[model samples]
Target: MEQNDGLWQALDAMAGEATEYFQKARLLQERMAGITGTAVTDDGYIKVTWRDGGIDGLEINPRAMRMGSADLAETILRLSHEARADSRRQSDAVMSDLFGTQNPAGIVADKEGLQESIDMMRDVFTGAIGDSKDLIDRLQRRLRQD
Candidate 1:
């Protein structure tokens, strides 16, 4: 019989790499959860904190009430959007630093670009995992034969 071409070792290495990536992903998620995207008005009367996909805290100064209910509501809404955007930027920066990947919004030019990137990755990983499975099966068959 010929040599095995180190297939088993290669598989082991892939597994180790996958484990390391998952660990890093977990760490990133944990850090993201602790992040609070904050926004405040120019006068520092109104403040907003965004977390876990929504506004978590809002502070309105008594003086802000002088703007009337309508203006105050509009300011709050504006601050919420700003806070959310700030949160996304922070998360994207951290993810890019760790993974060498830009946030989809930053990298994509087309309207559907983010989804397209995701689809491409899904296809590539699916094909790779399928090919790896086939190789493993073939190796197992050869082992049984031997």
Candidate 2:
């Protein structure tokens, strides 16, 4: 009976820890969704905003038209790249806040880390189940001896 109680306590504690991790993950998702990144050309003729990993807004100053079409296209493309980079930086910041580590690869790598944590928890639960089975077997043996 004492062993069963201890096993239940351990399982409850693990469940609580898993719940906390899931809550933190959800909060991080909300924060990342709200993040936006903006960039402007060096000459301030082109501006772009990135959200959810794509260009969400753009602004081209009237002065930008004075440049040759090729130059204007190049500037816009460069600004777009810069905006995407800015978005990556923002995502990394959010990931760092959630995971205590910063990497530019963004959420893909973090998902792997999250999976690993879940795997660890699964192992813990598996071990707990094995321990419970062993305890039950021991108790049955004692009962048989009596």
Candidate 3:
């Protein structure tokens, strides 16, 4: 009976921690979804906005039309790349703040990290429930024998 009480206490503590971890992960995802990045050409001829892994907006000055087709296309591509890099940096910063890690890539909970966490939690709860069921069976058997 004493052993069963200790096991229940441990399971309760783990469940509480798992709940807190899940809430924090959800908050991080929401923040990352809302983040955006912007970049403007050095000549101020073009501007690009990046949000949620896609370009959200763009602006090109009329004077930029003077350039040949290739020049204009090149400028847009360069600005888009810059905007993407800016967005990635912003994302890294947010992730770093949340996880408190100096290494961005290591701590960022990408698809793999999120999946691993979910799997681990599932396994823990599964094991706890299985243990409780086995314990109850053993207790019932002992009571019947008595």
Model 1 lDDT per residue over 1-146, tens place: 11234545655786997897888888887888788899999999999999999999999889998998888999999999999999988988877776665443465755577788789878866766776777789889999999
Candidate 1 residue spans exceeding 4 A from truth: 1-3, 102-146
Query: Which digits, one per residue and each the tens of the lDDT, describe model 3 over residues 1-146?
Result: 77678778988897896787677688789988988788898788899999978889999899989999999899888888899999999887877777664233663547677678679879877877877898999999999999
* Candidate-wise lDDT, in order: 0.82, 0.82, 0.82
Range of the 10 consecutive residues with the lowest summed lDDT in candidate 2: 100-109
Could you give the candidate ranking by TM-score, starting with the highest? 2, 3, 1
User: lDDT by residue for model 2 over 9-57, one digit each (tens)?
Assistant: 9878878967977887888889988888888987887899989878899
Error of 3 at 38 (Å): 1.2
Steric collisions counted per model: 0, 0, 0
For model 3, give the 10-residue run with minimal summed lDDT: 100-109
Q: Root-mean-square deviation of each candidate, in angstroms?
A: 4.7, 4.1, 4.0
lDDT of candidate 2 at residue 133, scale 0 to 100: 84
